[model samples]
Target: MTDQALPRVVDQATWQHELDALRVREKAATRELDAIAAQRRRLPMVALPDYTLTGADGPVRLVDLFDDRQQLITYHHMWFPDAEWQCGGCTSFTAQFTRLEFLAPYDARFVVVTQGPIGEALAYKEKVGNKMDWYSTADSPFGADMGAGPGEGFAVNVFLRDGDTVHRTWHTDGRGTEQLTHTFALVDLLPYGRQEEWQDSPPGWPKTSTYSKWPGSEDVAAAYGPQGVSA
Candidate 1:
């Protein structure tokens, strides 16, 4: 590596001083995020229709998606009908969540809802080795209602269950979903960040087109193996 590609060397004390200053801002940002979450919790919710989604076991009501839990978080995976491969961003994002049993103790459950048909959705899920329970909204208005309609983009939704009734408490899409992925988080810790063109990086740092280096479906499948993708 060239010297221009690396951070300038400094004495230990100087390095510690810079890091301490950054830590103050980092802690402040953390507190701001916590405050935002607190505000999110107080936001009102809207009631939802009892939409039916197709699962491995066949038609299942949206209310049942919670699996008896009071709260549910669903990732609306993007789909390209009849295509050989699917959205790599969606695949990679959803793949990070391998085990969500931890949410069970918090009285919540996480699942995936896609615009593809049940059979094809399950097949793709298996091919990528995802472990999260997946359902299809192909036959229902659920995907459209959730802002992930056919040919559209991906989304993350939050819901609350009251007996047989359900309410949508939160929804986010686009870059807002970045917080759910560790890949970006870890990469951002590096000197070059994601290497995406849009990132603000020092001169001489390597950069590429946005998402040009993101793993594709084939890459994910190869890494995880058939029926081995953790999430």
Candidate 2:
């Protein structure tokens, strides 16, 4: 590592003082996030049509995705037909989530919905070693209606089940989905902070093109093998 990349060395007292100052801002940011979540909870929802999505076992209704749970969270995975691989960002983002049994206590179920065919989607999921339940919206308007139409992009959506009725509660895309992944959160704690050009890191710290460090589809494919699970 270059000398310029290192943080300035200081006495223990000075280090603690600087850290304490930073902690104050961090705490404030945490509270601000809580406030924003409160607002999200208060946001109104829209009732959705009875769109049917394709699962491994034939057709399934939108409300069926809840799996008897009151709430549901779905990751709208991006798909490129006839492409050798899928979106690297979407692949890496979705890979971070393995076991989601924790959501059961909250009365919620998490799954993936893609714009690809069910057979292809399931094959990709197997190749990537993803364990989450996946469904395809290729024949339905579900993807377009949920802002994840063909070539549009990836997104995270939330829904509420009221008896047989389903309502769209919330949706987010871009960096908004970062909160769902621990990879970015842990990387942000490093000195380089993703080492991306967009980050406001200390001068002289190593930097590269935005998301340049994210693993590619081939890398993921090789790591997991044709049918191997992620290590």
Candidate 3:
């Protein structure tokens, strides 16, 4: 049978109703995952050590970036100064960094660290109108120490600090544009949300629309506007 003429396993109404039900199930699953995360937050904490990174005013220590806070979430953008262009994926990720203030109440500070020179990093941040603090790991070996250096793989690593000690808490390296969705981790517990996009759909069910092809190249920045291309 041709693709469009496949056997009708279920009628349209039944299929849509099932899709709606699946969406509800996915939302329930996400809620459970969030509750588990809340429990994880109450786990025992560890002290963090002080580490310094280069900033506009010269070397600014890690403790200073924390601003006396107990936790820090660094973006660790992949900005090899000499590269022809910044990492397109990293560029997309930084574009979403506009909502940095929303993360403050979580008792953590967010900052971006790049391997580019102070001038280049500052220029990119200015171009994008970034609200978060930006730093350059060019001078010190901080990027290498943090596993954010070129070829070591990319990830979002969360660290905890108390007094003068720092400890790694969590990290995630989602693939593709999906990786650009760290903020989505906080999506609400609604039936028609996330993971639901891929849930079961009966025969003849229409596919969900998307912004771009999955894991599209860095060149798809036109739709992302200046936010994605600024860097």
Prediction RMSDs, each to the true structure? 1.6, 1.5, 6.0
Identify the runs in model 3 with alpha carbons over 4 angstroms from their true place: 1-16, 35-49, 176-231
**What are the per-residue Cα lDDT tens digits for candidate 2 across 1-231?**
656568889999999999999999999999999999999999999999999999999999998989999999999999999887899998877776778999999999999999999999999888776778999999999999999998889999999999999999999999899899899899989877899898788889999998789998777766764644445
Ranking by TM-score: 1, 2, 3
Alpha-carbon deviation at 157 in model 1, angstroms = 0.4
Candidate 1 lDDT tens digits, 92-163: 888778889899889999999999999999999988877799999999999999999999999999999989
- Inter-residue clash pairs, candidate 1: 129-229, 130-231, 131-231
Give the count of colliding residue pairs in each prediction. 3, 0, 7
Global lDDT of model 2: 0.90
What do the candidate models score in CA lDDT, each in turn? 0.91, 0.90, 0.65
Residue 208 of model 2, lDDT score: 95
In model 1, state the lDDT of residue 164.
93
1-231 per-residue lDDT for model 3 (tens digits): 545424347999998998899899999989997896797676665444466778888888877777788788777777754664566666656666666676668778878888788888877666544556788877777677777774454557677876667777765665532434764455323333333346454455444554332332244344343565443
Q: TM-scores for all candidates?
A: 0.96, 0.96, 0.67
Question: Largest lDDT belongs to which candidate?
Answer: 1
